[model samples]
Target: MVLKLRSDFFHSVLLDEEKCKGCTHCIRRCPVEAIRVKGGKAKIDEELCIDCGECIRTCPNHAKYAQTDSMDDTLQRFKYSIALPAPAFYPQFQPNISVGKLLDGLLKLGFHEVFEVARGAEILAEEIKKYLSLKNIPKPVISSACPAVVRLIEEKFPSLTGTLLPLDTPLGIAARIARMRAMEKGYRSEDIGVFFVTPCPAKVTEVRQSSDDVGRIDGAISISQVYSRIMNMLDELEEQKSLQFSSWKGIGWARSGGEQESLNEGEYVAVDGIHDVMSVFEKIEMGELSGILYCEAQACVGGCIGGVLAVQNPFLSKVNVQQLVKRYPEYHLLDDREGKELVREGVFRRRRPFQARDVLKLDTDYRKALEKYQVIEHILENLPGLDCGACGSPTCRALAEDVVREKAQEIDCPFLLREKMLELSREIFDLASKVPQTMNEERGKQTIESNQDSGTATGESGS
Candidate 1:
């Protein structure tokens, strides 16, 4: 299939058509059913995709990948550049590697300066506590830290969009601070490039399509892209830069439950893995989770450490993060007074409200959508309901919707196709059983009458 890439929206998650086998693995695993196998290739619906990197994680053929910036290109683009590494980055290395050593290694990779995203997380954490203290804001304010989860809510759970914490992500906050510091050092704003060493594709998307005017990132580089380079420079570093400024709380954001831990609250629930997060969101929509005051949701299984762009195994990375967290003191870039000042400045808050995506609607017109929905229900009743993905849709209902939308036929379902074939076979057998009218007439009338008389005599004798 010649997949048509969307021009209207930017997505980091993409497909390698040459590597795709059309095995339906990604379509089945995609939480939003954004993928479909068409004409022996996988196609991604850019609008529905959340850039969660689930397709990248599940593709056995390594067909799916995340598009990220090249380090060489990033370095050459600007006079000054800063590296904003996620909290998850620290855990990708051996536990023995000090955070300061990692910062020094980044400097070797052509970055003039390195800023920790964890410091942004620490600042944001303080701001979050203050926000939580406010009354009538909304119950169970969801964390907006995970860009993928935030997009997922926008696409699939739009009603809960209001519940999302209207705050800038750590990467955004870090990029903003890095830019300000660079400007203070005599670098022009346009000459300073802020690039994030991202752990996931979603962050890359966040950097590419950020709506924030203050904290715009120039580009995003995946951790996997620079892992080998960093590894090569680890031993040759001449000096440690004392670059470790973020505390244990900030660094802990790499793992599950770390956000809630920073809040120092017990009423909040931290859910990791995209599917589990969706399950909790469903409960919240049903009003079953009213007692909870906050929700920390991460799209990746072990939080950011489990992102597909990371090099190490997530479980091992989690342990590394836990060990690394213990080594750092509870130091923060911003004191309480400074944090409150920034909060008052609205530096950490989102400029625009989170809006819902209408990608899931069957039609733009309400009456037409209702008609299509009824058609889908009627078609779904006949489907096998196995959700086998053989029809190139994630579920039977999805196939039915596709049929209504003219993207597929009802016979796409193997069970329905088999029934159609059987029905045709029965019709053929019935047609073959009939004698030609000419042949029936050619047989003498006396022969037909004699056969009937013989049947009647046999019946009378048996009685």
Candidate 2:
């Protein structure tokens, strides 16, 4: 079983307690149930977190943030660093900026060279086309681009493991190509670094991992983190049109339906947004979604443009990406020859395919875990079942599970606490009504003697 230790999880996404108001927005918004409210604070379970960046997007307090490499720090790591900007980064301006402008911006930032990850997307798309054309590719072969979506399948929807297409992501392909290009220029491999201008925490986590081919990329910079720096240099535009490689076909990859376009087939569905992807995957698991050759599941809504770290409004950014696509020619800079040669050499392939994370394995002993699950179910039956979120859980059943596992107390539920308080009040009132045993006996005797004395006095007066 592939299991992730909590200690080994990347801390790209972190919560600022001082800024967090414990509003429960983040906990409830989390797709994987990785977050919980505790002690008036939001706590993230590292073992369960997929680094989706949804919490960062949803948090009104701006408490959630991602740690990314800065310009100074990133440049210092290599004698020559290459910038690989995502296609989504292209649409920051209204007129829809040229790819040349973006590449030039990276050059000004001290990168010896700039590569459009979009170009990589085009090559990967070509490879995917060849794979799909072979028709040997599995029905509903899912895209391997978005790390968050891939991790989601690994963690939550393990049943759909067969649906994942065994292809390296464009980012991974681009990194290898960039290194190869640098080596051709007589630079040592160790001296050249590839820094991705990323848009989400998933990419950051991907870059940090040594195992992921895409992760092997030297480092990453979040778009929002470096937006100001790039913006400052935007007005001083130096267009290196010759250096530009990706076309509008590559730019089509910036949004949700672009991959479907790349496939050149209408018999596919592209689902964007984490929740939508989850719902669609559930249908796929149930064998409800049929007749689709490919499934493109992107974690961010409106595709990569809707990533959490984006400074531009997602809707506007999305428009910008679309405009860039329509204005430029489709296959102007797609390098089929070199891309295929690299693919043939297994340059863009992984040693082993991704496996499901053993998130459901609560214990090594099956019998013990089964017994514990039974107890949790029984505890769940007694819960209020309102899923109020007041108990720091998304659902009453979740709280029951937590209580059974001893991770939380029953009193954490407001309804349960009120019942307990009422029961304690009744016990206190009953105790107050009764005296101590000896004191009660003495009081009883005095009452009887007083009654007898009163009767005798009445009799004597009558006589």
lDDT of each: 0.87, 0.80
TM-score of each: 0.92, 0.90
Q: In candidate 2, what are the lDDT values of residues 1-463, reduced to their tens digit?
A: 5455543577688999999988878877889888889988899988778888899989999999888888789899999899888887787666456778777878887889988888888878877877777656557788888888988998898877767878777778778788888888998877888898988778887777634332358888977756678788878978789888888777778889988887775588899999999999999887787578889989999988888877788889888887888877757644578656796767667543677877765557889888888887887777788887888877887787787667887789889889889999999998898775356776666666765878553322221
TM-score of 1: 0.92
RMSD of each: 5.1, 5.4
How many pairs in model 1 have backbone atoms within 3 A of each other, for residues 3 or more apart or on separate chains, i.e. clashes?
A: 0
Checking candidate 1 for backbone clashes, the offending pairs are none
Model 1 agreement with the true structure over 1-463: per-residue lDDT tens digits: 2233343278999999999999988999999999988898999987789999999999999999999999999999999999999999999999788888888888888999999999899888877888888899878899999989998998899999999998888887888778877888998888888999999999998888764354778999999888889888777765474677887889999988889878855698999999999999999999888788889999999999999999999999999998988888666557678666666756697754577877788898999999999999999999999999998988999899999989899998889999999999999999897665446554445455665877653322121
| lDDT leader | 1
Candidate 1 at residue 383, lDDT? 98
Candidate 2: clashing residue pairs, number: 0
